[model samples]
Target: MTDTAIQTRQREIASEHLLFKLIEYVEDRHPGLLDFLEQSLDHLGDPADDASKDDAGVRAIAQRMITGARRQGTD
Candidate 1:
């Protein structure tokens, strides 16, 4: 595989690991947190079409925000 493909696969693995860990943590400590998050998103209304256009960029921004919030002791 090319270097880019290798790096992309690594990133996908890392993201999946992070997601699993997050769900586990939330389930163990904050019960219903995931449901609340889903509801919050629904409240924002649907943007499925627009989201597909730049989903990666949106996810990257969300990851950064979550990381920053954790670093600041806000989450």
Candidate 2:
């Protein structure tokens, strides 16, 4: 596969991993956290979307997820 295609696939995998981790976290702690994450993810739109490939956009989405997870973990 092309490098770009490979990178996209990797990002998708990472996103899935993050989603799984979020779900696991909710199961272990606060159920409401999942709802917040789902809202955040929805706001992020499709990872494969052209705008999502922009470096800043990707970082923003990842950062948001990480921040949400960290906040949930601490609570």
Candidate 3:
């Protein structure tokens, strides 16, 4: 695969790992958390179209918000 394709696949794999690990950690306590999250996304979502570096500033801000929230371990 090309270098870009490899990197993209790596990012997807890593995202999947993080998502499943999080579900496993809290599924027992919440019981329906997985279903809740899947359902909630229908109400809250970003663009699903192709992105470009032209929006890197907005993307970077969103990334920081997510990473910062993750560090706090709670909303």
Candidate 4:
């Protein structure tokens, strides 16, 4: 694949991971979170602006995941 294709695929994976984490975090409070996410799947993504800026949304997820891991003593 070309560099652009690889970048786009990586961006899509990162967005999917972030969305998965979000639903996992809120599933207890919102019982239908998974179903909602499945129905509104297109809503998840690293936005075009953020993607242009080097996947800032994914970076944010990395930071949050680190914080959460540290808090739970899993880091």
Go through the candidates in order and give each one's C-alpha lDDT: 0.58, 0.64, 0.57, 0.58
* Steric clash pairs (candidate 2): none
| TM-scores for every candidate against the unseen true structure | 0.47, 0.40, 0.49, 0.43
- Write down the lDDT that model 2 would get: 0.64
Q: What lDDT would candidate 1 get against the real structure? A: 0.58
Model 3 over residues 1-75: C-alpha lDDT tens digits? 999999999998898668655755676556666456544443453444656433545555445544443444422
Backbone clashes counted, model 2: 0
**Highest lDDT against the true fold, candidate:** 2
- Using alpha carbons, what is the TM-score of model 1? 0.47
Better of 1 and 4 by TM-score: 1
Residue 3 in model 1: shift from native, Å?
A: 0.7
Candidate 3 regions off by >4 Å?
44-75
Per-prediction count of colliding residue pairs?
0, 0, 0, 0
- Candidate 3 residue pairs in clash (backbone atoms < 3 Å): none
Candidate 3's error at 31, in angstroms? 1.9
* TM-score quality measure for candidate 3: 0.49
- Candidate 2 lDDT over 1-75, as tens digits, reads 999999999999998777857565665676575456555653553347554466556557656665666655632
